[model samples]
Target: MPLGRAGAPVDWLVVGLGNPGAEYVGTRHNVGFAVAGVLADRWSLPKPKSRYRGLVSEGRTGPGGPRVALLLPQTHMNDAGASVG
Candidate 1:
């Protein structure tokens, strides 16, 4: 994935804080996840994978030439990084 030229190579990992399950998927606290979804759509990205209590996505967010691999980690609000891998 290429999120446009970063001018410099950057390994970006965008984390969306939220709890597990469908119940908490759309609460106010999960706005990060919602925004991340918009970003994914705007960038023509695909759905993420689910595992370890979180949804993960890997893709770019920019035009041609060169881009960056943007990561969306939809982990719970607390201990979000616990399931990172």
Candidate 2:
């Protein structure tokens, strides 16, 4: 459906820790990524992409016009420690 109206923009960025590999899709090491996936579903996130070194999705939600960016890292599982700060 088309958007009802454009309101004041509010943005959010969510980072999930994980390795970027089909092999690690549901492994224990991807717990954070799992959570992010669930959250993205909740907020109706757009398709994930590889731009910016990992999977990224973004969109707006809610009456307050909340914009959100959700990221699942591509770094190796062992070195998953960085985030947008």
Candidate 3:
């Protein structure tokens, strides 16, 4: 449950914002989710799970890769604070 924070020990913080559910898939609004998926696949990371009021996937780039977390907020576009907070 490592989140991105200023002056923290995180290598990088990648955030992908989008609506939840299968219905929004492929739509322009869901580009964030799509990008996150691509990154996860490219990095061979595990499936995202529920966390921080959103779906989160945590993994390293490789055996000794830098730590990273992929976050997709389930809340609406306007109320993304819940996920970040």
Candidate 4:
């Protein structure tokens, strides 16, 4: 389950699947993305940057908790595998 640099393995991969356009912003289909955003804010992670064909943010969950990698795929839901893979 690790997806981080060597010696700093990520303990979790939180993925948010949604379409990649403004038209889908607040729709139910984007709920996963919205949740991911809330988690990132709550975890105090830095703003996600474009990477792996998606938006990525990495940080620990509290001081000594597991390391997490949040991903909001920019691809359409049907094509999310491109980003996650």
What lDDT would each prediction earn against the true structure? 0.59, 0.69, 0.80, 0.89
In model 1, how large is the Cα lDDT of residue 30? 73
TM-score preference between candidates 1 and 3, better one: 3
Candidate 1 residues 2-35, lDDT tens each? 3223334535656665566688767987787777
Candidate 2 per-residue C-alpha lDDT over 1-85 given as tens digits, one digit per residue, 9 for 90 to 100: 2211244333666788877778887899789899999888887877787745667777866545667777777777565454342
Ranking by TM-score: 4, 3, 2, 1
Which one is best on TM-score? 4
lDDT minimum window of 10 residues, candidate 2: 1-10
**Pairs clashing within candidate 1:** 2-67, 2-68, 3-61, 3-67, 3-68, 4-67, 18-76
The C-alpha local distance difference test score for the whole of candidate 1 amounts to 0.59
Off by over 4 Å in 4: 5-7
What residue runs in model 1 are displaced by over 4 Å at the alpha carbon? 1-10, 51-53, 65-75
Candidate of highest lDDT:
4
lDDT of 4 by residue, 4-84 (tens): 646577889999888889899999999999999899989999988888899989999899989999999989999999999
- Cα displacement (Å) at residue 63, model 2: 3.6
Compared with the true structure, model 2 gives a TM-score of: 0.70
3 in model 2: Cα distance from truth in Å?
22
lDDT of 3 by residue, 7-83 (tens): 33546567898887788888998998889899999889787888888987777777888988888898977888888
